[model samples]
Target: MKASRVASARSWLRTSNVPSDEYLEGIYYVQGRDFVDAGIVSSEIKKNLKEKGIPESIIRKVAVVTFEAEVNIISYAEQGTIQYYVEPGSITIEAKDIGIGIEDIELAQQEGYSTADDSIREMGFGAGMGLANIRKYSDEFEITSVPKEGTYLRSTIYVNGK
Candidate 1:
């Protein structure tokens, strides 16, 4: 049963009117509650981008990158903020959280290092691949953390005018 849930095809997206660039640049906050809520928000962003005439390639590119942010917030923080910038040239997604906070940013970004407990591993999340996957798909990435303070993760996805 648990295995089935992890393997289920994940499609996160919803459609609404595409907001103007000025509006997209505004800050937004999303609370963390496991994977479900993050997935919903991610889907909406994808839909927003698609409505802006962003190509499939660019839309998917942004989706994968931000999905990492969504997962990071949901998995690590009790709540998170999505402050974003949707511009003509690129989209910047900033996901911030105050949680247990990463003690070692370097180790966390490694492809196989995670602090997630056993239960997280059972859900197929603690593969130590979250940050690595985010970097692999993003055009620019940076992470800053302070012990007991929280973490600030920012990623920039440039459309390359596709």
Candidate 2:
């Protein structure tokens, strides 16, 4: 099952949009309960931003947001995809997942509030700061979830700190 999930993720990555001169846009598929894969996707995004000459400070913010989002997907969702767009003045990241969605968005946004299982905690993650951190590092953020259905998170970081 794990192998098949990884294969599906790899296949999605391969078929995603190729970076263009005007802007960079791509989607990374993530499989739930896959602890290691989250970091891989986060690092790839960081590398891409660095290669594009994005300022270190902005890159750092994006990295944190991406990592937090990835961790959330891995820890809770059954499956998800992170889509990123680097445009003229901003970088936008959208994560959508099919999973046991949050029951309370308000409560979930609080720092130190987590629904992680023992396995997630054992992995040294799920300290309940993912959503809060993601919102903190983003210039704009929005999240919506349907219980037992899924969640959608969108975050944007402006290049000029807008």
Candidate 3:
């Protein structure tokens, strides 16, 4: 990502870094319903991982998971954030969103199940594959949500195949 772009993103995105053992970390805030900005977080992440010399295979997994999470946030939430940490053995990504949370996570996890509206489908998204794809690409995955509150998702991809 360019310095100017990162600076601009930080302005509206309210990004922050918290010191930790991880080699790299970034938090990108997502504005709900902003389809134009939907993939920024994932693009930045993929760039960062590439610069760090992370293997392409692993990077691909991270990209897929991050993009899916980002899309879901844009499609469903009032607002959300995607936080990523790169560790020696694995990369972890967490997406938390404030919205009408999933009522049935189990059902949502099933392929071809979606609550997306007509507009989302019109955009050629909301194929009901987001959650399923995220889980498929991660070595470890967990999700939790309260019906009227929000949703939180965490996924970890092992650097050295699990």
Candidate 3 accuracy as lDDT: 0.87
| Overall lDDT per candidate, in order of appearance | 0.70, 0.86, 0.87
Better of 2 and 3 by lDDT: 3
lDDT per residue for candidate 1 within 85-159, as digits (tens), equals 777778887888987789989889989997777656555577889899888877888899987777898888787
Candidate 3 local lDDT, 18-137, one digit each (tens): 444458888888877777666788998888788778899999999999999999988998888999989889999999999989999999999999989976777677989999999999
List, residue by residue over 59-119, the lDDT tens digit for candidate 2.
8988898888888988999999888898988999999999999999999999999888987
Q: Compute the lDDT of residue 77 as modeled in candidate 3.
A: 89
Off by over 4 Å in 2: 1-8, 15-19
Total clashes in model 2, counting residue pairs 3 or more apart in sequence or in different chains: 0
Give stretches of model 3 more than 4 Å off: 1-10, 14-22
Models ranked on TM-score: 2, 3, 1
Better candidate by lDDT, 1 or 2: 2
RMSD of each: 5.7, 1.8, 4.4
Ranking by lDDT: 3, 2, 1
